[model samples]
Target: MPLLPTPSYTTSLLLSNGHVQTLYPPLFRKVAILDAERVRIATHDDDFLDLDFLPATAEAACPNADGVRARPLVIISHGLEGHSRRKYVRGMAACMNAAGWDVCAWNFRGCSGETNRALRMYHSGVTDDLHTVISYCAERGYARIALAGFSMGGNQILKYLGEHPAAVHPAIVAAATFSVPCDLVGAAKVLDRPSNSIYMRYFMRSLKEKMRKKKELHPELNIEGLDDMKTFAEFDNQFTAPIHGFRDAMDYWQRCGCGQFLSALRVPALLVNAKNDPFLSPTCYPVYTARASEFLHLEMPVTGGHVGFIRNHEDGCYWSDLRAVEFLRQHL
Candidate 1:
């Protein structure tokens, strides 16, 4: 029953090609999100996370005015190199806010346009920062919480929920995710292909810049051959693995990939990974895992590409936005 129907998702006009669907939203989609009230919270690791709150405009939805409003809140986590205000994050925030749900879009370490104090940047499996955001919202008094994430953020949410299902927060009722790379090793192989070089270069450019900043801040850290490195494999092997305590890139992927953890999930989680997503490999679909689990629902649409569920709706809501709100409403 958890494996969902994919026909529910229809691509926007002329966005049938996988790459076209993947590239269209970031290049052309501009959504006007609700006004955000920003807040910064501390992490247990001596760093911080910036949270952008878009409160529901109900009669009494303010955070901790008298008490946290009894509204259900959707906490959104963004993708790799993504922050709270990215078009995709804000677009979903706008859609959810219109449906009367409070929104908290949290930024990963160093992603809020500020250099983080920690030497290590965010990774696919870093759930502690997410836990900090979730704990903040839960303690603030919101009665219900639903989680939504894209790409890396989605992987983090899945890993967090499945890592200790019996210990998950009570208020976190459901999760909805899109364009998730549940299998990092396989996904990386696909990403390394020449056909996906454009996306790879985009990622590498930002990553290299961040490493340069790290080098400037922590001269003791070694980054001697950083420039020559071009692929995620080379970069993650040298930096992402050792700094984050993984033995190697393969070790990082095996430990962090959410596919292995789905069976332990206790809450309802709908992972919508587009069949045409240029970022994923065949192992990412996780059809067998979802079929074996009661809580994990995997939906693979034939057309929508990486985070691209573009639907030219009169309301400006894409298929993903509509589907997320619908699924969350059913469970919340």
Candidate 2:
């Protein structure tokens, strides 16, 4: 459980601090154009998950004498209010595809550019949907499957692995996560700060919009004053917690935070967090837990704000994307 050396992640001197390191790339990085086969997988509760499959590039694809495609698969779960089409998701998918791997970037409910049928939306701790996605991949006979998630998605992946360590599919060899908010209660406090208000505003706008749409679709559900809720904690207290069966925002965070469950994970997992990330609290570092667990590896870079891990101005590629692929390849 000893802490591994900080992975080789160098933040651009030009992009100083956590916010710049986190926001610059998403705002200016060249868009990654991908040709993906979109598949809608049905869930047990009759809802659905939208999955975008990017097959390995021809140069990277491995085929047998019978022309059967054989490549490792990487399942990517995006952050809050993010979908498979987001720039970072596509960028990482493209990287994995170029490295001789099939990439499936699956969207959480209500995130895939379509309204989800269920009244309940996805939360940081939700794992049943992840289980469904993994089952789909397992049934397809993938020889090696790795999982990667960003921010809130990272929290879900860790929670899933920890909560159901014994239930992981045999093909799921490893997992990687970036900029995870391991401590949800602490993260809420961070997001509530004035310095991080930009992010809070953006997220609240999206959440309110989604709630408005949900109210329209299900008029019977009471979502009154959703528009007035200004902060993440308030929004979650009014909607997310009750809809998902938690008592309130704090209760939801307490029950769902990944920090409490990391010790139970059995998979070879790599978790990367930045000391300067605006979204995390000190408790999110998980230093002691990582040092005590044989299966978990923690990488704490000095600066990589949120999900941003840009190395330099010369190369637009993300450090987290490359490192995630490398970590998963080790187990593959």
* Model 1: lDDT of residue 202: 91
Question: What TM-scores do the predictions have?
Answer: 0.97, 0.95
Q: Pick the candidate with the highest TM-score.
A: 1
Best by lDDT: 1
For residues 135-159, what per-residue lDDT tens digits would candidate 1 score against the true structure?
A: 8998888879999999999999999
Query: Which parts of model 2 have CA positions greater than 4 angstroms off?
Result: 58-69, 312-316
lDDT of each: 0.89, 0.86
Candidate 2 lDDT, 163-264, residue by residue in tens: 878887777888999999999999999888999889989999998889889988889877777768889888888888989999999999999999998999
Q: How far out, in Å, is residue 99 in model 1?
A: 0.7
For each candidate in turn, give its C-alpha RMSD to the true structure in angstroms. 1.5, 2.1
